[model samples]
Target: MSTQDPQPESTGSIRRVESSTAASGSSVEETPPSTETTESSSRQSLFAEEELSVLRLRWDEVQSGFVDDPRECVQKADGLVSDVVDRLTTGFSEARSRLEEQWARGEEGSTEDLRLALKRYREFFQRLLAL
Candidate 1:
């Protein structure tokens, strides 16, 4: 019924879902990683193990409920996905903030740039007035 081979988890941080579980959308709980993942290279940036487990349980409930109310199940899945996205983006947002701070040292100094530009403009104006 399927042609896809079971693939290993690319990042140590994210748990790999079984081929069956992924396809059927049942038992979406992530299995323990076969090998330890590096923290810096973790696929999931923000969610801790406990939080991921909770999300898996909640997702299982959402999938199981499809038999009763498909519409509600879809809505719940949407919410869960949205929550994960928010968590992921929060990591990026924080990293960007830190980078901005680091760049303030000289990499991206708008203050100095503005000062230089203003001085150049004054010199250009004075030269034009002389002409």
Candidate 2:
């Protein structure tokens, strides 16, 4: 006969694997996010930034023509600026959604940065359009 002390049962020693019927009859397993998803998101954000920068540069180029003109020229430039602002606003909205979603996945550094940059650029462009 072995000499051993009898141990009392405790919650820590319990192993209860409940049936799925207790919940939804199914267990969900989380999968890591795909690289393709991340890369595609990154590419879209980069494209938005590049597009805005190019548009801004073109606006500056065009504004040169109005530098020495009358009020009519200023009004025309104002209209053009408004159109560009609308386009940039749309792009900024889309990028903000994507960047926010990506950021929710715990990748905050670059994604947060891009979101802020896009937002700032949007505001800056709108200010210019107002002028």
Candidate 3:
């Protein structure tokens, strides 16, 4: 099996959140691994360390702009957050694929994968709010 699972289609969940943020933020911008979304909840595809590092760096770039460009910072933050949500969504799907493959092979599927994804989701939620 391929180590890389194909990324899924962008169903409207991210857009639904983006639309809500638009109503609130671009006017007011904000982001999800919504527990309400079964796909996000079903499995954990943890970010590889390199991916997490890049995200952290992107976040730093957004945050560092606050003094000179608060509005731009907000916009950039919105973009960065949406990117992270997309990554998480991909991660969840990859984990689900791995779990299913493991199951078929008679190996244990780690709930810890899902657990970590949930943790990242929670962090994403809290960070979006804090921004």
Candidate 4:
């Protein structure tokens, strides 16, 4: 007697899928991982660094002018303002240093140093704008 079993035909209407219960559990339908987003973010950081450097240079120039003529009348008003500016500048510089140190330590992501750095940067910009 013949003992061959009949094979099932593939139906075009319903496709066969790998069941999750199968060997590898489930087939991962992978979309392409993105590097473009990371590249753009890096570019943005570089741009911000460049722009901040320019602003720092400009601040230095403005500060130098304020000290060029140290007359009694001008000194009276300028001295207090200069002191405030100096404090802000120093704070900003300290924040930048801490941020750089943290980044060097590979703590760039979700760090307090980054937050402090951004905050100080804003303060520096505001001070510059006030001038």
Assess every candidate by TM-score: 0.46, 0.28, 0.39, 0.35
Pairs clashing within candidate 1: none
State the C-alpha lDDT per candidate.
0.45, 0.43, 0.50, 0.38
lDDT, candidate 4, 12-119, per-residue tens: 111111122322323332342145532332223211334345444544555456566646435544554464345444544554676678779987645433443443
Show the colliding residue pairs in model 3: 25-28, 25-29
Superposed on all Cα atoms, model 1 deviates from the true structure by an RMSD in Å of 22.1
Given candidate 4, what's the lDDT at residue 38? Answer: 28
Superposition TM-score, candidate 2 onto the true structure? 0.28
| Segments of candidate 2 deviating more than 4 angstroms | 1-83, 111-126
Model 4 per-residue lDDT at 29: 26
- TM-score, candidate number 1: 0.46
Pick the lDDT winner. 3
Superposed by TM-score, candidate 1 places the C-alpha of residue 92 at a distance from the truth, in angstroms, of: 0.9
What's the C-alpha lDDT at position 13 in model 2? 22
